[model samples]
Target chain A: MNDDALPPARAIEFWFDFGSNYSYLSMMRIEALATARNVRIVWRPFLLGPVFRQLGFENSPFVLQKEKGAYVWKDMERQCRKYGVALTRPSTFPRAALLALRVALYGANEPWIGAYCRKIMQLNFADDREIGLPEVVSEALGSLDLPAQHIIETAQSDANKLHLREQTEAAIRRGIFGAPTFFVGDEMFWGNDRLDDALDYCEAMSRRDR
Target chain B: MNDDALPPARAIEFWFDFGSNYSYLSMMRIEALATARNVRIVWRPFLLGPVFRQLGFENSPFVLQKEKGAYVWKDMERQCRKYGVALTRPSTFPRAALLALRVALYGANEPWIGAYCRKIMQLNFADDREIGLPEVVSEALGSLDLPAQHIIETAQSDANKLHLREQTEAAIRRGIFGAPTFFVGDEMFWGNDRLDDALDYCEAMSRRDR
Candidate 1:
């Protein structure tokens, strides 16, 4: 019923990027829903920049398509209202997520990963802070009572950088072209709206095994 | 609680394209949901091709993004299963929706629009028939006991063609960039996932007024 008892593939693999707005919604809300369903979450932090590049775009689809970009901002407002989350439109879109992503990668398997991600998302989305800065990221980790400087240093190391790269490549291999994608077994569910559907699938699968 | 009693802007404006896979999902399920909520449905049929072209894309985003295209087909299968609807992979994608869209435009304000749209969607997504053909459209109308030849002729008239063009232009002006878009007084909700959300919003607004 808990993380330890569940099979590795039985849990939902949550692949997301720090810079993704919709990912902010999932990062904020996924835990409570998963816990209620007794489903475990495997946080997999990766960059979407490379994914977009591979798809022949140098920017987010929101940026590439102007009408879509406008609709997204408006939609974000409505979605935030519906989800009861605060949203301050980021002045700098797609802020350099490298540092925050690497740091999230540092805590991916830890209990603190969820807290760290939520903190980073709050900085970027809720507060409109430049989350790409080391100071911002450090402060977020420090606020969580973690050794901020040490974690940031470790996250920036060449080996961890390689880990992040491999993770993004893995996401591409899994056919992920967008953020906030969830995988329950081999079934992939994209977008924040599908989070519930993904968790439902996970719970159903677990029940079947019982 | 009926369509006559609801205010014009209070009802949900459903903008869709015949070729859009997500639109198929919404078209099939919208009526029952709308009826339950005592919300009126204003069907607005438009072509996405021109919208995509205006955004500088010559084809659907699904065609432009390969990984996304593959994911969409897979997602369609999952969505169809979840909705308890049959799905046969269309041998031809984006099959000339021009004719079907024009026909739907002719029935936009009519009660038969929903049935016509569902029939067209079934022909394309459920039955794997080439819905772009005139005869396929005629047969679909005939099955509904409507005057097939007459409707087809009227739908193809220059004036109706003008109406369809103006509708597509209207969609672009309204900042719509995707299919299965719903509007409740300028509140735009895009994609099939947001259909229920849109309906709920409509019902909530109606309740507040009462």
Candidate 2:
């Protein structure tokens, strides 16, 4: 069907935290999959650190659950290989996502937001870069051919920080406890593997509307 | 290919605890898939309760992470609908699998082991019965045309008690952290969704041997 024949586009809300390996998988793969299925993507960036705290976790649940943590690392390696993406294990688990997330939401309206999200994840999961620093995020913006200083400044503002906090609170309200959660309308799909299911939900809606 | 032309049969070890929701999902579906793919199924019953305690968990991880816990219940419903299984959510989460497992392992040599397993899971997950009770398990065994008294008595015997303990230890030694963990020639796959991947691994080995 042509654009006019298509249903009113229902964009999938992708809720992701910067520190998640599976979120990296979803970020790298969601765009192409969503584009092919003609589902628009709404990239919602937030920190999982605060969310984890609510679960009484001192750190990543993976860190506490050692054997599953071992499997997670292996799963990431297998996934990176399958997706043909280079990944060097980050020496640190969950570098504070506060800075990256603030800037990501700040740029949420910019046309390059998706590109920006992909680059941030690649630098974290692939290059093992310290994305917690302002410099790394500045470098990420520069590479995207977007202005670095202004976006960085706005992201650093107190209002934007509060905005990011609100985004996180909203996520908690949505009953999201993990990163890379997706929404097709009010229906929730969690984890990177559920990406297709989210898209299928969108496609099913389109068919129903038609 | 005919049976004579095929390689020696390869069995996939299905390691599960009766209390696990995903294990119930796997138990409900594994046999048909394995049969169709010409792969043998090795039913290995063990307790995740002991395993979780070793990880410092007082209860199911699903219960600890309430939001994710909520998602898990919904996911179970979706999985059941998809698989054509009747799932009346158990009144209690993570019922003690000790009694059921010991009895299950005692029947490991019997021809009706798989059917017995499927029925026990249905009683736990579909009928909302308290599987921790010996009476419930006896009822399940009676329905299966098996001798309940002999099996339960043998399972409660000191030899069978030691056998079940050893199985749980072996699961830990094998690096299994969760229920419904599948092993196709020592390559481990976790969760019910991975059932297909495990079967594929066995089928590929069959092709390679041929």
How far residue A169's Cα lies from its native spot in candidate 1, in Å, is 1.5
TM-score of each: 0.94, 0.90
For candidate 1, what is the DockQ-based docking class? medium
By lDDT, the best candidate is 1
Quality of candidate 2's docking, in CAPRI categories?
medium
Write down the DockQ of candidate 2. 0.63
Model 1 CA deviation exceeding 4 Å by range: A1-7, B1-7
lDDT of 1 at B81: 92
TM-score top scorer? 1
Candidate 1 on A97-198: residue-level lDDT in tens? 899999988788888999999999999999999998889999999999999999999999998999899889888888899999998888889999889888
